[model samples]
Target: MRPVSVRRTVTALVSALALASTAASPAAGAPRTIELVNLGDSFSAAFGTGGLQQVEGVDSCDQGTGRDHVDELGSHPRVEVTLDAACAGYTAQEVEDLVSTKPVREALATADVVTLTMGGNDIGWAEFIGTCSAAAEAESGPAPCDALLAQAPARIAAASSSAAETADAIGTESDARIVVLGYPNLFDDRQDSPLISAGRAAQLNDWTDELNAALAAAVAEEGAVFVDVTDRFRGHGVGSADPWILFAPEAGAHNLHPTERGYLCGYFPGLLSQVARTR
Candidate 1:
């Protein structure tokens, strides 16, 4: 029989060898996964594309219809979406507020990557679209659109500042790689809308460009990557032969939002391209 001291020494050696082996090779079937967190407003929430469901247990947030870009990204083999904090109607300031909330704060603590889409609401984009649509329906000239355009520069500046602040706050709370997405043009300038003229559509598209530029600058200010989907979405706006954005005659929340195809094809590819380049 082995002596007790000899048995003890043998057991320690075996345990050390096992531990070293375990450390050298990960458990079978366990692949490295990236923890992704989604944060922002309607664009990030994928408001119009899918069936409404609660997000992070918040009924009002409507996050889990599975058609959002985050969901598309989560479908990636290497990614696991740990949190979806995006909510419709949320502004940049509101997203900043989320950083202080327990759920978002905890999620950020372990996030490997964070994606944000905001600032459109802060600049009254929805209202601008509605107002422009109404004027077009009334056969009114571009005066109303012009007035809104005149006010847009200041609003864009404010929204850009707010976005920068929000990005900074998110960076402060997490070491995650931040990717911000810019809004796409809802109208194809090449075609005339039944309600709005081609020139007006061009104007709206131009405004979208301005908004994207401002957002890009703001994201850069906070060291976040800004992924622009405009190129991907070109010729796919409301007036295009094949529109990716939802268009409804009556005003509602989902109008102007991307469809599932839009998320899957346009936004997701744009995001992937940027992430790949950065990585």
Candidate 2:
């Protein structure tokens, strides 16, 4: 879970902020604070990162008051937050739960921004991981990995489309900058590549690509922001670029999940910047 940084594609923040110019801002007397509502699965939830502190059954990440985005983005802001409601292995349906169960007034009543990363679990990412791994191991066959990946394009489209609808609905009601984050490399490509093939890496990455792309497209169509972190996570595994995740079989590994280091290195940077953008 310790990483400096991976080979990032570096989509600059200036360009990302320019995309959000139509949202509402806080009232003049209200503190110029960025109230972030992270409604997603584990990644944005700050799970395993020990960054969240729950109060009265309500979860909130450290926003550093006027520096919530600054603490995360390493800069200053009027106010920032690290709201967390991300559950492990969340799906499209679970998103409704995230919003419905929360104290809406506390979390979304004055929400300036919202970030989500869903639909992978909806498409059965865990199943895809196991299946794709097995298929990659059985490389002697007619490329079962290819067949499994074939389903990704359609599944991602359906799941993302549904997710986009939900985001739009919430955004309209709360006037928040709804940002969607894409998944990273969970599978090791070496498994089928004869180099390392740790489990079902290649096929899984390919499928991940499909899901990520679909998510980006959906966010765009929904008029929400898209925060892609796919390429940055490639070297998270053992002997990886930055080793953000512990190769499995180890105890309590955040495998298939973003490591704390990954969070500091890439996730938080890309995310906080988008959340702090002015409308």
Candidate 3:
């Protein structure tokens, strides 16, 4: 047997070596998968994308069926889509209710990221468009459409309030990184036809800008990221020869929504850029 002093010294050296080896070794666990939860209205619900054609009477918007920008996020290596709570035709108020669903709440508890697109429906965008288009068809001056939307300020205020409230509600249940996406302008600025005059188009675009600003302020106040896709959609609005937005009064099913190419190239790029920044 070795001398007691030699043995004790050897033991200390061996123990130190073992600890050093362990410290130098790579960690032994797999990378944690990011759980992503999507919540909001039609934009998130994939509204006009895919090949969803119109049905006679029923809602052509496939509601929860379409896959929107969430699919883009899930394509990232670190992400897994845990819940997609978005639905067609849902307002901000409706989204608040969606977040209250049992599965959605449960998903939020463990979610690493949550993305939302709301407020458009709350501001009654579709109705506003219908009214404005009708005025345009009548060849009325910008004043008629302007007067029709005279109550816009009040409506915008209510939309803003509801957005902030929804953000607060989401924050309460989720510690996840939240992203709120803003809508793009439906009309471009270049040319003006007799119908939907330049002034009228500008007015419509202005309201959309206001809505985005409100959404940005509300989401920022709640410590969430607000992504504006307006610039991304530039040169590709409703009247552009290669418009990203689909617009045909008869093709009501996808009238105001982004086309598949628009979502993939336009919306997806904007969203992915934000995700990269956050990561």
Candidate 4:
């Protein structure tokens, strides 16, 4: 998979650029007045995949519709979607700025389902990367990826705690399904590939496992649902007819953001499952 950490880094950068140009408002008079708010980083912000424009009647944003996840539903739990808000390099703390801060007032207010794929880019993955990178330098070539992979769970746990505060906020409001969408498998978990290095794939997958566990715990504590995307994305692992993986030349394809096919198959399929579970 060309190393998931590296790919996610590229996805983070492009996601930031996309977030800078988009804004989220409210969707009105749709089915059941179900307000769907997507608040998170670039993975949730699909950006120029459709480009920016104004959300009608709200008179606040000009961002396009592509960044919205509820729209990705197609028919699953169908509702009117708001492109909502996405902040690139957005930490757990930054989520408040969009939903509660002075800049965007209605970004996350009174919604039926609020979904996000966040925190990995904000946590200490870079430090893990540095550790892996240094290990590689010392061992020569790709050996450091092993060390980096081992340390992923602890890092994600810490990050999820910080992100959990957002779940807490949603709990306070009682307006939406506080769904925390997790990052998918980013590595092969197998050591036979040249594209990934050493035990690097396993390490990344291990970290993702740890992170998902932490997320599940955090969500349960907050009375929310933590949707596990691991198995689903893994099913689409490289070479599957419905691959959720990012390959080459797809812009941030090297990163963890869903491929267009991944979106159609992975995000939607798994997301629909999550919606069904809650309903």
Candidate 5:
């Protein structure tokens, strides 16, 4: 057997060699994979497009359809989607509640990024759309539509306030970057559908612009990034030959929501661009 000092020095050398080997290995120096958490409403959930599938540890109401912008982002080789808390018909308050849930809170703690798409339901966008469609169809006079339009500014302000509060709530739980996505204009004013006149479409687009502006301000105030998809969605509104928005004559949950292609092409690219700039 070797002498005690020689044995000790040999053991130290062996340990140092092992550590050096590990340090030189590719896995040891590789960047950690990014963890993304999705939170918001139907748009983030990709409702009415991909078939419903239950996500483990997620609430039944928050099941993912596997086709939302979150999924698109998750497809990146370096990113892993740890949680998707978005649900159809969820308002800003509902999303806040989701963030407070134990599983979501745990997920947020480890998240590197969080993406939110909300405020539409908070501002009664669906009802406004219905009113606009009815007016365009001549099923009712423009009074109801006009009234809803008049309410838009105030409602948008209130919704923007809620968005800021939600961002604060999210910030408290995670150090992740928060990305808020604004809704796209649902109509192409140049190509009007029989159910929606060009004038009505233009008015609706203007309302969307107002909403986006308010949301951008709110998000900025909260130190979160706001992604505007309007440019990506241009020329692909409801009346376009290749529309990205869903159009239904009867009132339904899916109407005016982005289709699968819209999420893939519009929301994903817009978000990716913003994320790259920040990085």
Candidate 6:
């Protein structure tokens, strides 16, 4: 995998420092308890987006970052950030593993709302993208790209299964309103990079589209709310002049997670909208 970019690390720290003031504190009166529990992968964990709250001893896992949409949700006056069980590089199965733990389960038990954004890693996005890059280099036919697209369906099915199972597990633990967020398209237009062919970008977007569809269906099956952030992130994708999502950052976090702007403009609004309804 690629290292986190220097640009990303600096951006994250600055954004996180700015957003730190938004962290909600209990009001003077008897604290209006709005218990929010977050689960899933790096998106929810606020990895590269900055404002990272490193979990005390668990340096490896980004279970404590608070600058993503989850932080935005917690910014509401009454919301208490009881638990952010999300970790970078986690899949739906890994989320299930975290939820099954005693402390995390306890947090879920008191949760008023739970949000999940997972499955990209499970679908093997990096490997698929790698294949696409290779296909872009090929001077021959569609064989290389076709091989990657062919695997999408099975990948989607497996990921959907894991998502459904995770939803069920969360359901059993808390009566909190669940919201499963979708991934954003990485490119709003054709990439300017010589490394990525038009065909490759289209194929990758197709994979994202399929994954979002499967996730939506799974959330519906579990009677959970599905928040689609795809539209919000449209022109702000990776290839845009001012992309909301980060490309392969070389150090602190994963490659394709949202940027600080993505969380604030793309994810934060959608999630904050749900708070009133879920409550």
Per-residue C-alpha lDDT of model 4 across residues 54-158, encoded as one tens digit per residue:
434333433333423445452233444554565545677666445565323454555667777667775655455445533444665554555655566666777
Q: How many steric overlaps are in each model, in order?
A: 0, 9, 0, 6, 0, 9
lDDT of 2 at 95: 70
The candidate, 4 or 5, that scores higher on TM-score is 5
lDDT of 5 by residue, 96-213 (tens): 8888989999999988789988899899877877788845448778888888889888999999999888988999999888999998988889955865778888998998899889
- lDDT (10s digit) by residue, model 3, range 66-154: 44467755754455888776767778887787677677789899987788888988888876776677455476554656676897878
Model 3, runs deviating above 4 Å = 1-30, 50-67, 134-144, 193-195, 277-279
| Candidate 1, poorest ten consecutive residues by summed lDDT | 13-22
* Model 1, total clashes: 0
| Model 1 pairs in collision | none
| lDDT winner between candidates 5 and 6 | 5
Question: Which candidate model has the greater lDDT, 4 or 6?
Answer: 6
lDDT of the candidates, in the order given: 0.77, 0.59, 0.71, 0.56, 0.77, 0.73
lDDT of 3: 0.71
Q: Compare candidates 1 and 6 on TM-score and give the better one.
A: 1
**lDDT, residue 194, model 4:** 32
Instruction: Tally clashing residue pairs in candidate 4.
Output: 6
Worst 10 residues of 5 by lDDT: 13-22
TM-scores vs. true structure, each candidate = 0.84, 0.71, 0.80, 0.69, 0.84, 0.81
**Position 198, candidate 3: lDDT:** 59
Residue 40 CA displacement from its true place in model 1, Å: 0.6
